[model samples]
Target: MNHHAPLSPAAELHANVSVPFERAFAMPKSVYTSPEFLALEQSHVFAQDWLCAGRAESLPDPGDYLTMEIAGEPVVVLRDRDGAIRAMSNVCRHRMSTLLQGRGKVRAITCPYHAWTYNLDGSLRGAPAMTLNEGFCKEALGLPAIRCAVWQGWIMVTLNPEAPAPAEALAEVTDLIAPFDMTGYRETFRESFRWATNWKVLAENFMESYHLPMCHAGTIGGASKLEEMVCPTGGAGFNYHWILKNDSVPLALAHPSNTTLEGDDRRKTWLLAIYPSLLITLTPGYFWYLSLTPDGPGHVQVLFGGGMSEDWLADPAAEAHLASVRALLDDVNVEDKGCTEKVYRGLCSGLAQPGPLSHLERPNFEFAQYLARRIPA
Candidate 1:
């Protein structure tokens, strides 16, 4: 009997830099395992680069405030009485107590630690014990503001109070999905789940389709072929676009005012990944928004939300479809996270070293390279 080749559960590491351009793409596994690297990313990457925080629809009017943590720094986003959305440090200027405990709306944030109050706009408004500190100046003690920008109805905040507008960096990403009426779509359902793998592993997993037929068979196997998907990397290694097949016939109606698209343009499904973190997927008439946020080196939280036009929200059946989509996708994500976490554990083992990247996993390789190049050599 002829002997069969032994099977291996592994991927090839790319060493050639030729055909894909001069820069051979690769990211070291340590980028995810080093504490110093994570801190630098917080101050340099997450703090300086735009981090998508909340949705525009959430800030409906003045006094509406939402709180979230950015690179471990707590921040509060709110629309002031002037109707302007602003991101402010959640830390009260006085006594250093955090201004907002969690997410919600409030007329004004009053620190429970000392009863110091701040206007929704982040200005110091009142102090019950102003006389207690003769030198305390309310104007000088106002909460500091952060750089805030909005694109495609999503809010992005940067900690560098004077960082340049993210419009230029995020503009192209916005236009890529402009054909769809996104703002008209509200995040009818929202969720956050913890993944057991390195953030980069999850990111890499998302950046390519090589494993779709193998890894996603349970969820995306029906009308999709991983071989048919596309990954064209550009934008300083920070942006990449790819397509996926969807089984649903409802999302095919996305032909907008471009006018050329008609009722017949529904044969294929397209998915685009806006680098660093954002996946815009189209299925039938449904638009899915997937956000990948890093919690720690091997721990990440996936944010799943968005889809449907406001008109769809008005329909009673909308909730059912949204719920169904979330449930299906959520199940698939759980499976992926478990697999990636195992990969991370293997990487830390002294028994093995890093390997190659397949031509099919180019997107994944490109992502690893991007991370490698960004961190200090």
Candidate 2:
């Protein structure tokens, strides 16, 4: 008898990541379940790319801020005294304590451990006992800064200084999304949940509509015909698709603010998956996004938020209208969560392999190509 070592599932799936769209197979189970691959994605894919932290509207006033992590490095995104948005390492310069846990309006970022304080601009403002140390100049110490950009009201940060600006990278996407007037939309709701799936799995899942008729049957899936979905081949930065809604349907069938949009644009929905981790869905009346972050090989954290267009927010029955929309969105999310969780479980069972890709899953194909180009074989 002879003994042989088995090939790792992740190694087996590496070839599928770059297969042509028409001939592409589903992502390999190892891609979702391997710690090694997850580590690579964190370093090469996320750390080097722009990531969405949250909506700028959430931090309306100076000193308002939010905290998030990229490639496992903690970061704080805030508006400084001069009202400019900035991003800096959340780790305290003195003892490495995380400066902030969540969102709040703060006059200055002060470490909970030693009360070492930093100005809104990230300059060191106070150090409790550091004056006693020789040559410890507060002027010379501040939280390490990361590149930050505000694009269409979303706060974006990148660990790599040389990466493309968010505005420049999203210039085409901005034009495609401009008619909806996202800058005028006010973020009204936010919710977060942890999923037992790889970040890429969730990203690919949200980017496709082929599963809608089956997976979201009871909520938004049945409202549109399968034949009406059209996915556009996007360029380097992102990919999108249109799902035309029936005029008689209840949700987003007829938005009062859609008067400015032309025939199909007014009646359909745009689903865009920005490279790396931002997933956006824009309709005539409202838009929502998910900023995805990987926790580890086995989990991902999703920061989900949405807004109503200024016009829709001004309707006399806005409260009741939002209530209905929220209910539908909540249900639809539950459906997605259930499906992705099941897929992850199946991938972990050691019997998973790549399956044929559907024409409707073109965005997933492009995303696979994006990852293949970045991650080493």
Candidate 3:
């Protein structure tokens, strides 16, 4: 009688997903549905990786701050008086109350519960009524700092001190996209919302162009040509694909006055999925991104933002162009919401199984491998 021990779920997943691209299939249903898997990912992947916070330019002055949570730890990213971006614990040292609630300019991080104030640099500025306590030491009570770095204008933070800097990890991507001068693009707006779907479902949806003609038919679908997309093998820190745009959206192409990009490069769009969960759509004229965080096993929180490049912003009809782009993105997001939510629903069925991946889904396959490598056996 054969008495081979049963494989643990993580071990089985690792074995199944670590195959060559030609033999790859979609990830198992448990990857998106299992609470235990999600917890493992939170501790091992999200907490250890360099997560994109937002563009540094968004916090133009000292005291401008944004709050986000990483693997259940609240963090506040702010500009100090010295004009450097900093990330620190948003939990007040005293009583452990959350110090901030969203993004805005602030004079200091003040805990709403007890009003223990912290300076922009996260040093304790004041703790009312604490002077009598001999054990209290203000010098030793600053909010603990997290590792923070800026790469290609994006603010990245990691709780793990040993993670590679974003710029160092994404050096190849920088070289490939050098001509576009991504840092020259300025953000115009940003918003956050929750969607009722697994985070990876939305991430995979963004990684491939296979569903563009069907999922986004009413919006940006007309510009996507399955035959024109190029999906090369992915690198260690990222996956990418390219699509040549049609004339359907003028802003999706290079501006008339832009001389930096020439010929076919002007109409090409790069879809980049930076490992873990930062998805960027970079075009010659504009760029947009989605930063994802898992809210739970069944839901994802998204940070959506976009803007035009310096050249496009200087155009005589820039406002009209931006308005059109925003409108189209809104419609495309609605379509994606519907599609990803349905996928999650199907994965919940007892009979649901992963199918073989299409050639265009090369990026998705690479993403699965990334997850498999990060989550321990």
Candidate 4:
């Protein structure tokens, strides 16, 4: 008898999705509905890849910290005493209690359960009434460290120590948009919320601009010309598209004093979908991004943030521009939330099936392939 193992449902779906762009179809509905599929992604993709936590600038001072979960593992990214950003387990070494909650400045990582304190560097500093235990050693009992690096100003953390550095993996992206000086853009605001949809559904939504005219009709739709949207084949770690338009928001275009980006380049907006789950909308005068994590098969956790470039920040009308940008983004987000949730609802129906791909959804096609390559059959 032949010893061939049958392909998994995910692998079969992947095989169907891995065709040429012209013949490509949307990812099957099971990808968004199956708990098993989500588990595979959690282990093979989220756990193995460099996941963006937030902007490094947000954790500038020593003891500043932000907490997030990766594939169910609690991780805290913080600036240590030496002003170096690092990541470590958010679980306390004693009693296995969570070390921190949300984001804030802390002198030490202390577990509220028993007051087992760890320094900002994750080294165990104090554990009350532990001297009686003969096996206890504070030096060896510090919180476990996770691999972390800053790439283009974003703080990235990984559970796999052997994974490639963010810079090395995103080298092509770095060169592709170098003139923008993405690292120089400051984050003005960030908010975390849950969405009623699969993480991939939201990721695909961000990867394509095909739905702007219909889904975002009330907000930015009038300004979004589908004819101007260009979707090219994606790179190994990311996919990107371009929208060249005279922006409705003045600050969205390049500043008069700025000379780096010339001509139409000043009005260009890059929709970048970094592999697994970081989505960025980078413009000459401003930038915004969404970092996504799966809450379950039916829900996703989102870190939404955006801000202005240094030149725009220095402009006399900066405050008004920022307020306008924030208002527009908030409205856009409301539109997206409704659309994505409806998609998720449809995926739950037995009648739902993968449809043909749009030329503008090339990035989504590439994203399906990426998922196929990562999750085992």
Top lDDT prediction, candidate number: 3
**Cα lDDT of model 2 overall?**
0.84
Count of clashing pairs, candidate 2:
0
Candidate 2 C-alpha lDDT tens digits along 303-374: 999877777787887778778888888998899888988888888896676689889898988887777777
The order of the candidates by TM-score, greatest first, is 3, 4, 2, 1
The 10-residue segment of model 4 with minimum total lDDT is 5-14
Q: Candidate 1 lDDT, tens digit per residue, 1-377?
A: 64775321111122222235334444545566666667766765666666766577767888888777778888988888888888989997777888776457888899989889988777788988677877988788788888887776778787876655666765665565554545666765666677777677777766666766767777765555656656665554255545544446333344232353344333344465555666666543566666766787778877767666655556666677667767777777776776788888886777756556666566666654454444444
User: What TM-score, computed on C-alpha atoms, does each candidate reach?
Assistant: 0.84, 0.95, 0.97, 0.97
Full candidate order by lDDT, most accurate first? 3, 4, 2, 1
Cα lDDT tens digits, model 3, 1-377, are 65797666577679878788899888888889889899999999999998999899999999999999999999999999999999999999999999888989998888999999999988999999998899999989999999999899999999999898888899989988898978999999899989999999999999999999999999888787888889998898999999999888898899888888888889999999998999999999889999999989899999999998999999989889999999899899999999999999999999998999999999998888888888877
CA lDDT, candidate 1, residue 346: 80
Model 3 lDDT vs. the true structure? 0.91
- Steric clashes per prediction: 12, 0, 0, 0
Which residue segments of model 2 deviate by more than 4 Å?
Answer: 1-14, 248-254
* Prediction 2 TM-score vs. true: 0.95
lDDT of 4 at 271: 89
**Cα lDDT of all candidates, in order?**
0.65, 0.84, 0.91, 0.90
Which 10 consecutive residues of model 2 have the lowest summed lDDT?
A: 248-257
